[model samples]
Target: MQARDTTALHTAAATQSPEPGKKRDTGVRGTGTQIALARSETPAEGTRHLTGSRILCADLPRTMARFTTGTLSENRAMLIATEVQDLGQEHRGWADEQLTLNPEDFAGESRKALGDRVRALVQEIEPVTALERIDDARSRRFLRLIPTGNMTMRLIGQNPAEHGVLMHQVLSDLADSKTAAGKGQGRTREQIRADEFCGLVTGEQNISPRVEIELVMTDRILFQAEAEPAYLQGYGTIPAAMARQLVRGRDMELKLMRWIRRTGALDLDPRPDLRDPGLPEPGAAH
Candidate 1:
């Protein structure tokens, strides 16, 4: 998974067991509010946040899995973020238990903090849902994209030339995803989308994605992008300049080009075994 530091306002479930130890701590921008010293409602004590494996559960009253108890209060808490979605963790809202949201102020927290880097995404972890529009559900159509650096490119059409574009978009999406999540295509599908992606990117440290790329491939590379042009996750179709950049000085036989389509499926098949090839050139890093 790539590192993703999206500005979000997450609401903890009131149904969750009181934070362990139930002690109070001061609240900051990223950290939860300081509980401020207090007594526990029960026998449990020394309750700190339980950083565990994330278990996504939409429409779940128990969005928070399990953490030992800390203390209890008269419902006094602090703001965590701007992603105030209903059951959904990514969809954000304003009014940090104080402020209200204006139409133009959508993604306000993330914009103020991470800006263009934090994309508004509603990924389907389980049930496949019909994608909706950012502004209004009236336009419930899904948009194709290719993520590059800070922004995303919209995949408008398809063609052979589009394939080159698609390849670029997918790579950008993958790269962004990797940088955000800390995992890559080398990992299983599930492992690639874990919460670690968010922890590594913006929330942890702000690193510029634009620089250079150097893939040290010791074997032949089967690089088939969208044959016509395909849509990326947060980004849209691929870009021509990026595609042109990928085929630098590699052997002609090592690269495979194809046409990608807008609604086309990807070929995630493994590359064929290559004969013993010399060490790949260690190119410059961006």
Candidate 2:
């Protein structure tokens, strides 16, 4: 990776060569020296960038072995190196060994799928670190609402990967509906989803058809108006008020539902559901 970064630097230098009799810019691409410069320039963020770059630098030889011999494509090699770049040196060696020794594992696979596999291996190599990182990330979870001009806004939310996939499945179902496919309406599926999003959030349209949104909350949260939060399955956590309002004045049936975690294990106790005649929650109770 150092060589690759240096090659990039050299290519840029050549492209910007000075005219005759003009002094050229002298820039050193020494590995550690550049990392120090990077840190000084952007103290808060650069250290992380440089450290990641250093890992890739150390792993480049093995990456090139895969690249040069045609066992992995250039992109896949970089993807694997980047995914596990923060792993400990010993674990990184294990990752490299896996890549080289098990070429068939990632051969001819999609980049996204291959990246996932590589990351999973990294988790295997250092499960404790992986879990700590996951918890740290969950602590930083947030949702952003950005308003575009012309009265439109963008909504972005960060959640667990499982919740993300479940949310996508629901929106996709709505976006692909026949009703959403308004004849000669001239709206793209994305635009339809936008409209559907507005409708659903504003209580104008139902979130799902045939299926009801299951609401799971403690009795205290539901009946006593407690400040505690409620679980909304594919939607992750929601405010207790929202969950209460959804069930207020409605006939809801309480049922025992199984709660499953990302690891494919069920919770010890069966989850309690507050299901109205309306749509049941898309996925399992959170």
Candidate 3:
């Protein structure tokens, strides 16, 4: 199958077991083995190329078929295949099923669309496990203040995706209002937003709008420990752990949604209480 990294592909093929009496190429390193072969090369670069092919052939065989058939580009095939490599076996299977069932949807799509579609389909490899991982990752969130040479300071913020979107929307709204009021204003939206941000931060403007965030989660995920990610409004989907954090200590009302198995429609759960007598306790014996 074709691969994003030709060097790695040839390397892996060269390393395959040789026919009887024919010795494997031990004297020469495979293209995939470049990092190990050369002292100057970084391991990460080699790993990316090497793992790309392995992921395609082993984890996403159907994608490999498409690659060999010239239906998918090497980069796109590698992109889709490697994305599921982090998922658990069950989640990987789900992703594979989606790809197989809807081949037409992925054909000739842009790289970003392909990535977003894959993320939408897979949700999380293992939501509970992924939640734990996101907790660990949260520690890395930060804000940096850098002073540029031109007497200006740059503010770099690294926040949760939902919060970032909220801030952007607020600033964009202020900027839009300012621009609309001024008839021949030539300032771009980006410039207006920057000025509005300065106005808010410097106490020139006192606008405190309550940020509204919407979360969509399955009942199984909310109370039964289902391995499904949560969808955050205005920010697409996020890990369930992040969703939990977003709602923690906040005054909010819960709305239950029931999935009609027959029609595949999501409707409001009429039952106020979430408890089900027929369902066994998590660890209870069948």
Candidate 4:
């Protein structure tokens, strides 16, 4: 329905242009269509959806039929569209037909397995195009950071498969070693890996500057055994026990302060005494 609406909007815009013989610009048409769709939050997201819709509708009728019939999800259909995008129209159609001939078979495959199957088919049908796509994708590798709502950020990196696998293996080995050494006590393997990653990236495994962080919690939660959670200013809420561990452990230095709030506003003196003894040694028990 989104694709059909977008196509209709494009045709309408093109036909209603001031100059009878001249068509509206492609960018203008796309912008108008995307705005009319209003299903995506950003222009990039809208463009991606539009591209997938166009490819599925125009080049992969069988896949589109499966998608419409609820056999394939939009994400899976988009995966198929992306895989065949580099192929010529004839080859793209052929790949689509081959993939969707048995809808049940195709739909039952896992997401990763489905992608691998499509890539395999593309390589078999058009090896040169597949290679070209690989080169194109390799050139677009990037690392990005996105801030999620709750005071946390997501770090995403796109690398070649070999490099990614190797990096994961190295992190896993480090985490396993720390676990075996009794230094990773009170932390999960994933948590240990995350600490290792931060240490390596920030050079904190070696000598590093003192870092200060703010932790907010009610006195009941901090002093008593209250079940309330604590908020770590930049990281988000953490369990009360974890917060207590952080304060009691060598990682953070805590100085008590009191604030009075009449309204729902919190104000802290800017120049309140500050102290940072130092963070705990890497792999040290909390």
Best by the TM-score measure: 3
TM-score between model 2 and native: 0.54
Clash tally, candidates in order: 57, 8, 0, 0
Better of 1 and 3 by TM-score: 3
Q: Report the C-alpha displacement of residue 26, candidate 1, in angstroms.
A: 35
Could you arrange the candidates by lDDT from highest to lowest?
A: 4, 3, 2, 1
lDDT score for candidate 2 against the true structure: 0.57
* lDDT top scorer: 4
TM-score order of candidates, top first: 3, 4, 2, 1
Following a full C-alpha superposition, what root-mean-square deviation does model 2 have from the true structure?
12.6
Q: Of models 2 and 3, which has the larger lDDT? A: 3
How much is the lDDT of residue 109 in candidate 3? 79
Give me the overall lDDT of model 1.
Answer: 0.28
Those runs of model 2 whose alpha carbons end farther than 4 Å from true positions after fitting are 1-52, 67-74, 104-107, 180-184, 209-256, 259-286
- Tens digits of per-residue lDDT, candidate 4, 1-286, equal 7666655655566566555654557545466446535974566767666667778888999888888888888889888988778788999899988996776786467787787678667666665555466557657989988999898788997764434544576677788778888989899999998888889788777522233446676544444534455555534444455555556552223442323222233233233232122322222333
Task: Give one digit per residue, the lDDT tens place, for model 2 in 8-78.
Answer: 54446546757688656443223335544644644433334444444555665676666667776655665
| Model 3, span 157-266: residue lDDT tens | 77766556677778867876777789327888888888778888899989855444556776565444355666766656666555554544222233222221222333
Q: What CA RMSD would you report for each candidate?
A: 21.7, 12.6, 9.0, 22.4
